[model samples]
Target chain A: MQGMSPIVKNMTRLVAGFIVLFGVYIVLYGHMTPGGGFAGGVILAGGLALVVLAFGEEFARKALTHEAAKTADSIGAMLFLLIALLGYAGGVFFTNLLPVGEVGKLFSAGIIAPCNIAIGIKVGAGLFGVFVALAVFRRAGAGSSTGMIEG
Target chain B: MDPVLLLLLVLLGFMLAGSLIAVETRDLLSSVICVGAVGFGTSLVFLLLGAPDLALTQVVVEILVLVVLVRVVITRRDETHATSRATLPVGLVLLALGVMAAIVFGTLATGEDEGLTMRPFGDPLLNEQAEASVMAPAGEKAPEGAPARMPKSAGGAFLAHGLSESQGSRGTGAANYVMGILLDYRAYDTLGEATVVFVAVLGVYAVLRKVGRSRHAGNESDR
Candidate 1:
């Protein structure tokens, strides 16, 4: 296939960058907007994928390491579970142990916002890790196919 | 049309288009994109339905599915495509369409009005509080320093309305009251669901890692 023209490539990268920024905005305004952790996380991942496609896979790998992704995923899940456990100790599971503050405010959602952040990290990293693992497996499969022919 | 209804219609349109694509596309990757579109539609619907909780869950699950599906498609990119007859597929499609149409029409005809106040969940507690009449016992009333008794309408205070007579506007403890209901009243069920999610994550991680490692080993052997 012919390589994309310079203009097209630049446009793609620019759009991807915009998407990533918009995702952040949605996530932060989750309570106010029609978006939240899951929506924003996927959008962020989409931007990352676009960058990889436009630039190169190496760029993405360098920006996001497998080890770091795994650690982030684990930590996110653990923090969420800990929050729930804390609620349990307080005689409620998933209870808002923290103050609720004023409704519709940034800090108003209490534990909900933190929970959303945890979910975002967990989902984004877990998804990225899955893709990485699959790519590695696919490469191995290709190598094996080639070997069979050689033998 | 009302803004809410208009939004709902838009979401429904997306859902329809996504389903059509998912069913019509022969390529697995294209089908996966269709599924993602369907997820986007559902998330929008959830947002309109005043259920942010469900919307968040849907978005996260959709990403997980998209990632796994894309990985599969890329790995199998070199595989050959197999074509099938269009006649049988068309016939099947017509039959499915007819069935869906009949079901939808029947359900709509029988369904209650959207504005219907009565529901299968029974009368609302907010409107029926006078009939239920939950009041705390005299001795149970807290001393000056103790936490205030929760109201009947407040979450988790289903058994005895601890502070029905009190005139304070839900007090400064509204958040605590709600939290108590969510955690204390429904702890067992919520915990069960959380445990299930936790286990699923572990399962996905384990299976994925094993798949990766095995493929790596196999590739080395082949080389």
Candidate 2:
């Protein structure tokens, strides 16, 4: 796929970093914030998507390949499940093992913060991978022969 | 006659109109934009109703959906024949809306038994006295089989104890009760939901692999 207009590219460059940073902020402070892992992860995916749309598919593949995204997705899921299974040490399936620190602090909310990070990573990577895969693969496959508009 | 209710109704009407326009519009691009309008309206309603988390999710998801849909439409030319029963979908949508409306009204309707009906929007059903007993500290577990000293409803209990320094055998210590509920109280549900996302992405990659697409060219259009 071809890159978008210079106007769009410039705008994306200006805005993408903030989007990613905000997403990370939301994920990290999910226990205290209104938006949590899922929402922040989607925002992260949107940031990556903005970059991809502005720069084109080849750029996306180079910066973050399908393999990398898949790996991140797997790691996130595994990390979340591992956090849950580790609760076995507490004699329950999903017990909160870590000490629930003082309220209103960043380190408070045992298992929640880490779980948020894991979920954020999984959701962001998975959605980005899907978007890249669906859009990029089709463009590469049906070039010229399909007689369709290749925009 | 409350102003907040009036505002909520206005937003709901706006969303309904946008969705109707989206469904009725013949042009795909207009339809997509109208759907986005509806989504934005829903997000606004969520914000108005005091659920910022839902509002955040709705807004970002709506944008992503709009981007994906527009990308798909602009990339590919329309080649499929128009459906014969076009109004059938419109009819089904209206029917579903009617059913949903009925369910909403029915759930809100106050019957002979007060326990059955859903409480009004602003006026919650939590007993004021439940607040006094929810101050138990960490390492203290409620006795087995006995009702935990909490508010009547499950959600009420979470609201009372979710942010508390101690929450049954362990201290949840969550500033955001919603986070406590999602991650600590209902972690299994979150796990299943994550798994669903993982599988969906996997399915998309598997179906759209380079080798399979190259081998069976034009097979995509068949679907």
Highest lDDT scorer? 2
Q: What TM-score would each prediction reach against the true structure?
A: 0.60, 0.82
Instruction: Compute DockQ for each candidate against the true complex.
Output: 0.19, 0.59
Query: How far does residue A50 in candidate 1 sit from its true spot (Å)?
Result: 3.2
Interface RMSD of each: 6.5, 3.4
After superposing all C-alphas onto the true structure, candidate 1 shows an RMSD in angstroms of 7.9
For model 2, residues A1-151, the per-residue Cα lDDT tens digits are: 8889999999999999999999999999989878899999999999998999999988977997778888999999999999999999999978998888877789988899999999999999999898887678766665443432221
- lDDT by residue (B1-223, candidate 2, tens digit) is 6788778767877988999898777778888899999999988988887789899999998999899998887765774454666355878989998998876676446554767566554433444335324533346543333344566554754454443435632367777777887898889998999989999998888777776444345566568
Predictions: Cα RMSD each: 7.9, 5.1
Per-prediction TM-score, chain B alone: 0.56, 0.70
Q: Please, what are the lDDT tens digits per residue for candidate 1 over residues B1-223? A: 4567666766787899889889888778888899998997898787676656567658756765676677567545465365675566778989998997776555334235745323322122443242222333445543233234333344323434423322111221222333223333443554454456546656655654433344356568668
Worst 10 residues of 1 chain B by lDDT: B166-175
